[model samples]
Target: MGGAALAAGGLLLPGTAQAAPRLTTPSPVALDLPTVPAPRSERTAGSALRPFGRHLAFGADPSQQVVVSWQVPDAVTAPFVRIGVQPGDFGAPVAAEVRTLVSKLSWQKPVEDQPPVKPTTVTQYYLHAQLDQLIPDTTYYYVVGHQGYDPAGQHTRLGDVASFRTAPAPGRGAGFTFTAFGDQGIGYNAAATGHLIAGLDPAFHLHMGDLSYANAGGSGKTSDAYDARLWDSFFVQNDPVASRTPWMPAIGNHEMEPWYGSDGYGGMRARFTTPDNAWSQSTGIYSWRYQNVGLISLDGNDVCYNTPANLDYTKGKQKKWLESRLAALRADSGIDFIVVYLHQCTYSTCHDNGAELGAQQDWAPLFDKYQVDLVLSGHNHVYERTDPIRAGKATRKVASGDTVNPVKDGTTYVVAGGGGGGLYSFPVSDTYLGHETGNDKPVPMVVSERGGHEQTVKVTWSRVRYTGYCLVAVDVTPGAAGKPARMEVRSLTEDGTAVDRVTVQRG
Candidate 1:
């Protein structure tokens, strides 16, 4: 266990674009990389300490591949990962590829008490071990540590052998469940929601964005005071849940700190091991499949207006790639549902967060044209769901308890931002629970976006709006030859109550 002690694959590298070269799996021997040492100043953060923030992500392929990643505060001697089916008998250990991020912050400069030194870069090492050809739907025990602190070695008795299960075989109709939420910062509610998600036992967890709020400045401009050390606390806080479940995340505005790199996701790319099949170098956009569902993680910052940091950074290439992917997925008979997740909400009523007009212009029409089953988003720190929509209009009055067939009713947009961050308020009272529960009168809601654009609309389409920390659990039941497939999406509160739920059926 690194940081705070918490209980914690290679398929072909698929290119993001159709024209991109398909990456073949590298030879096993090709995974080796030379070791790097921790800087003098940053070594105090714990260079050779136990690993922490252990989490998982899918490689190009979900079933036969998985990426195990963790963080070491300082430089490690020889960081590696050992895996096996048994709890304590890892036969061979695979060396982990280490990537370090050094943040040059003024506050990190040596103080009066310390030896006078040049501006010290607060260095943090992120280690990743790619496990390929893993058995599908099977649990494997693994441990992450360096040379001296080896968990599999005889001298060390570290009881940090964690386990993770690979995704079920794609198109196998294995019937798996996945959970998702965004805007999860470090807090009690976020930790509670994570535990609830783990209780639900989802195969993977989708963190739409705004992961740690480390880059607290929502705007992508230069931070007032960027603190790279915050990730140490946030990852430790989230270890209870993310340590076990695969924490697949999308890039958010907060993740785009201008001090880091172009488009502000250089820090993110260093930490996460998301699929790089896309053409975007930021590693913000990628796609993967789990059973009969196709999940696309988009870079909402490319279309977000409030932040405007990296708007159009992709030069509309992400949209083109997305359209191509959606069209291909829709044409595939085996893919019954397409769920796209991003940071900004494409359609949300909260005036604070507003609607992501860039997302609307770039991807909403494509979602409508392809009839995407579900669009999940964050940025707005509340749980909000739109009625089945087509061309920015309600296709069906999606009241709670109504089962919607997206093929006929269009797509349902979900704003699941309440994942531990401070909740934001809505301009109008909530329609579902606001007036129905003896609160203020449910006034007509106004959807606001960038450029001071606001539209006062009736509340007939906003079916479920819950203001609290929650996680969305989606169960995909594949349909047979003659039967229709069913998906039950539930927004569970920190207390494990289903605050909002919807059933989407497709034949």
Candidate 2:
């Protein structure tokens, strides 16, 4: 079949399937910031206070190093992490660094006629400890606390112990699985998606950003309805699975807090412990290698059209860093595949912010140039996938049961933004990937979001599109020169149904 043309208004030819109507962007209405009734005293019992938001992250090397992080309600002295192979015996404790963030919110009175709501100060404490020289592919138990609140205490039960396994040794050619999604907030759907991701027992998980939506208004305005308490609730909701899995992430637009320090990642830096390899100030743009897969997490906010706050923060430094990283990874003989992830997708047919032109312009060429295998993203709160694309167009159609060789063809883009946010609709029919058949007509597409104009160009590259809370689970098998590696990607719905699947081969 012939490809669809980019018609006027950045849409697919009219009458092609249409996406559901765009969601009403939440306005920055006057909102009262939650008040903390009691301030944290200078002295507090540590051992009795258990950590809530326990999470894991990888350093420059996944196998040799892992970063353990968590949050405490009050300031605790000498916060640290204890790690050991055996559950019962946690070896010597490694000192953790404490970073305290105070969010100052000045909410304007909704009704000028009434008394104005006073400003509020919300202070939070976060702790991080890096565990080095860890054994590969070995599970290690850990506990987080300071002098008074040690989870290893006799009173602390076994259930309080959290554990994680390091990545497999490099060039081991071992098989492993990982999952990814984005746009999750404090909701039932997000919780449900976390439960589903846990079922997969992935080695690590990637969150493409828009984490909690604590700032209901996604725009990066200081006056945009700020509530710091929502983060506490959101972390608790995610603690079930994130406490165990290595939760790596890329910066989303919502994470941009202009009210805070440099580049709006100030809050993010205090919350999570990421590799200290970002070009800009703690933007979470870095690269790492796990066995045969070389992974990169880009800061999509730098190249996003919808959120132009802090535009050109890197002034093309990020793009240059990405190209260098991709080239190095591709040249490595042990590396079999290159996977890049970010918040905004480079290709999608979602109604609101379909394919972001900034992403395509800034990074798509680099992906094509490097022959990156799979690009994962989530921002539109839906599931969408593109066929093998080259030069901003589909080189060939990809369907379920199809095996694609990224080394031979181009990269495949995936939008797994349905991690518990409200579902989005296709402009036309709901054409599921593996379950439904496709129509010949063109579909609605958003071409750009410049000056509030969301332009779209309809094309046949949309191989799979599903409207539901979903995520991507990928099982990877490493291989040498003679034997090519295989990545089996499965898109699953909330009910554990397999919406779509594809095999990507790389040598």
Clashes of each: 9, 23
lDDT of each: 0.75, 0.78
Error of 2 at 230 (Å): 1.3
Candidate 2, residues 1-507, lDDT tens digits: the string is 001221212222222111212223343544575443333342235544567887788887888889887877765667778888999788877987666666664531222222343435566766778788999888899888676667777666677788898887897637899999999988899999999989999988999988988776677776666676678888889887988898888888778766555566667777777776754344678888888899999988777777677667788889889999999998998888899989987888777767778888989999999899999999888888878999988888778778888877799999999998777777766667556766746566786665546766767788787888999999998764577789999999988898889999964
TM-score of 2: 0.88
Which has the greatest TM-score? 2
Best by lDDT: 2
Worst 10 residues of 2 by lDDT: 1-10
| Over 4 Å off, model 1 | 1-48, 107-119, 156-158, 431-459
**The CA-based lDDT of model 2 is what?**
0.78
lDDT of 2 at 94: 94
What ranges in model 2 sit over 4 Å off? 1-38, 107-119, 154-156, 280-282, 449-452, 480-482
Error of 1 at 150 (Å): 1.3
